[model samples]
Target: MKKIEDDIRKIEEEISETKIILPYGVMSITLFDLEQYEKIIVNINREREKNQNLEFRKSLIKKYKFVFLSKKRKLNKILNNLKNNKVEFVPKIESVVNKEYLQKFHTYREDISLKENSRYFLRQRINCCINKVNEELFLLNFHPSLYMNSMDEYIGGDFRYRYDAEAIIYEDVNILQSESHHFAIYTNEKTKEKTKRDILNILAYLNGTPIFLFTQNPSFNRKIDDLYQQFDLLDMLRLRKNEYFKEETEESISLQLPILKNYNNYSVVLFKTLKHAEIVDLYHSSLKQFEPLPRCVFLYRVFEYAASVDYKVKIRPTEYKQEDAIEYYIEKAIGYNPNPLYYMDFGSRKVTNYFTKLKLEARKIFKEWSEHPYKKSKTRGEIIYNIGRNLVAHGGNGEHNMKYDYDKNYKHINDVNIILELIARYVIELLNPGLKNVVERRKIYYEKQYTL
Candidate 1:
């Protein structure tokens, strides 16, 4: 318990001290992990109340209150007041008198062009920041009073409105300076406080504001690196591609190897640039060309093959006698055992048995590599095979559990697609023995998948 407590304290201290470095002249802000911080704050408050330590509680409360109020005041002081700073001018109305009929009328036009111009400028500023970030930025304005009872009919009534301003800004730019006018919309007293809080939250998350404390220190770089690696933004796009293929063909065939390879290439580029929407579009377009197949049959085959491979590659490997385990499972599941030496031995058995045969084939390949005294123990083919197996057998669910199970298996339709990719790469290498570039293979695979 003491050791655990010490570890927790150390982690908390490290988190508190971690700082991010930004480009020169930029101020960095520290964004406390909001979820964790909120939990801690709530627990502390509860504990103080439970202990009935009035004086101590009051002191702590007063200290935090002052700090909060002071920070709020500083933010408010820095904000630009759009309403007050705006200049208003009315044009003089001239009466046109006609001598022949003695008819006179006054012409008036309220020129809020300056206001409109200022709004446009604000919008441009926002857009520019977004463009810099290279990602989508949405804006929502709830200026009810400005529109509800306005003299100008041009103003829309009290309504919630949202707009997508296509802008992508890097995470290190000053969002406040770039979108100053957008922030000014909440100048009214009714929404000012809420608006300020929202702005702070955005600024904190962006961690790009020049005044942020976190960006000042180099230590924060590792945290940013960890964040980038944590999420697989490419998976959703790949899943969508699989679904599209499933729908188009009426068959849930695993994505073909060539297609998966291409997707990986496309994914690498998109992920590096954060172009998620483009990846989705590419997936839809690619799936539109595939021929349809029976969905049920495709899904069943996928599951059967996945389960067989999972048993051999993951489960059988750990058993006391790997070959015996493979033989036992093959006989039990398929009512037959494979010779493991023949190339066509794969498709001759039940789909599950086929997977077992494929695993055996892979093992043979590895053994051959090992037997060659001059050859490397692990070739690229071996690496790709192992990766493909792990991806299907472990990827999504393995992060949480250490125990192995056959039933909670990698029998998903997508696994077959990955396997196909490995097979295709292997075949391509066999044909082009001198070709050593994975990127070229990836590009070729992508092009073929696009055609499919």
Candidate 2:
């Protein structure tokens, strides 16, 4: 009976030491926390080294024909304690020495395999979620809050103004951050109609009466087919290695006469010849002699022209007094030169005179509001207007210019738009006072046009 018991103990010992056969390429089936698993891998490596040493020692012992006993039983007990303590297994095994011991080992190994597969699946799902969140954040970053708020005003309300808009998308490719916004103003149908009407009115006022005949053929008449043929012939000749021949051939050719197209059908004359072609060409050449002129130069010229008109039409006695009052102011605002020939000779100077006259006319109308005691108290528009004028005249830091620092007060489109609105309002008041009803009829129009 003791011999049978000893045999059973030996079987149990061998079973405990044996490794269970797992799925193909499967090395381990032990379930452990991250730290525990790391420790198990380390132990496995150490045991493998120790086993090699033991095998070498066994070889020496076998050569001497000496009996040897292993301390494996003690090591197995320690390994069992490591596995069993603070660790639980699912699909539990009954005994290590049973006939069904290998089957039980397979069950535990399958459980560990499934657990590992589940961990991998969960990690992938979490990663997918993170990627989706990042994509949404990237898209949202492009649509800035400020742009959306501005767009809301135009998109909503009775205006229902849905015009074509272009946005330049600027972003950091590395960090996925948007940086800038730029927009272009386009003429809508309403704006186009208003511009046409204004142009016709100005033309009528300038030419004594509204001449519908000029509107019929507003643009310069030119035969497109003749121009095309001339261009093609010139291009073909340009490729030839004979400049003398090309010049001689060009001189001999006669261009077809282009019939003038009448623009009488349109309500407004869309084109004008302010200066004769020869004079315009001379003016262009004079402008090219200087660096590009500032916007104020153009504004100054407009003002000069309006002043000239005031000189011609002495209709408004108030305008005459205003003109005398503002003449010195305009001259001082811009340094005056007395050479009439120099003014006439310089195209940029002439353009400057025209723009300045227009601005002065706009300002004169705005100043009329100051006649009322209540209007005089409101200084916001007046202060901004003065700042804008100074900015245009001097090319300084605008309202932001200070002793210690420069501030760009008009940092946004809305701020600049407000200044333009005030200027336009003043212009309308001066040009068409009867349109005061048209201007005052809509409170929302002023808000939409100028709010910052």
Candidate 3:
């Protein structure tokens, strides 16, 4: 009971300084001043209920209830945790005003129906409330094998990409290139778990080298607590002196392959869809393995996931092996007009010839393991499914199983990985065609970088 009383006293002292002033003769109320704040909240709810405009009501709810009420709940949680003996707790109130809310805020401010003074007042109020929540918070994570190249545009500093619109200028994330290993630090608001998942998915699909990281640097969150200086925060990142981070030999040479360069143009919808797929978990599992055999097992799980999803192409039930479904999807994906394969100019020679050469080599390797007696009888789709996807995964049908000799078959596995990567790229293209050009552009750049 004494502990609870002490926590209550501390919270009351903090709450006294938390009053936010609104425009248009509204009373100032701290979040802890529940009775007064509740009256305002109730009034907003009533307005939302009575207001006939469906869109206007939605705007009110998104801006007011979703943003402010959520802050109230978070405050309560922080106080509760404090009472439970959790020390050094700071309210992450800034999280509520993320990219999603910023869009709504801009939209609301632009309405010609609302008086200019009223709009000005609301904007000021919002800025005042949210800006206080800013303290140069960085959610940090380190990659094991994969590293990033510095862009010519942002030399010395990290490559910062803003997924959300430029309306909120401060909202952007930096993928930093340290000495041998790479780490990413995101500004604005993201929980550590969500940031880990987001960075992994971005690296996996965009770069094609699925990499894993040690747990996030807990020190960054705790060390920077109440430290709001931008220069001080940046100095810590440059040092990169965390015990968790260490350099390792690059596993997949595929990291040298061309990767998507321009990520700033993509919408939140793309990210949300990628998260929903949850490929990172499978890729993370694959990356933890030292040998290629176990790696192939988890890598196949990604293909298996794609196979399980619904697509326009329908296969007969008898024909629908896990590999077959994915094979069909890959074929359908590559058939897009202008084709992603030709997005970059490799040389005067047609790209088809290059792909054909690769296919021929892959086919010869496939011949050794395919169930079919005659390699000539099988289609391109079948070769990819049987050899690239399945053969490396679970050794081929007859005597030439890949698992017998890791060193001898390493080249074969790599050759198969190239073909499989193309299939994976096409799968991503199918999901969001807007990314095709970006993905191809990055691949071309990476190829040049690798040769250099």
Top model by lDDT, which number? 3
In angstroms, give how far residue 140 of model 3 lies from its true place: 21
The candidate that achieves the highest TM-score relative to the unseen native structure: 3
RMSD of each: 25.4, 33.3, 18.5
TM-score of each: 0.15, 0.18, 0.39
Report residue 424 deviation for candidate 1 (angstroms): 36
Q: Given candidate 3, what's the lDDT at residue 68?
A: 45
* lDDT per residue (tens digit) for residues 1-452 in model 3: 24333444554455432333222122221122334333444665566446444345435433342334434544555444434434221232232223343344345444433333233333354444443222111110121111111111111111223232211111133344333433444332232345545555554444333343333455554333222111111111112222212435311211122333332432221222242345545644554444445555666666666566544244446556654565565555444332222222334222222233344544454555465466457755565567556676667778767654433455445444544544454554555444445444323443454444
lDDT of 2 by residue, 316-343 (tens): 4554542342333343333321111100
Which segments of candidate 2 are over 4 A away from where they belong? 1-262, 265-272, 275-297, 311-385, 395-408, 411-452
Weakest 10 consecutive residues, lDDT, candidate 2?
A: 152-161
Prediction 3 TM-score vs. true: 0.39
**Residues 86-119, model 1: lDDT tens digits:** 3221221111112221111112123543334333
What is the C-alpha local distance difference test score of each model?
0.28, 0.28, 0.39
Clashes by residue pair, model 3: 258-443, 259-442, 259-443
As for TM-score, the candidate ahead, 1 or 2, is 2
Cα error of candidate 3 at position 77, Å: 48
What's model 3's lDDT at 224?
35
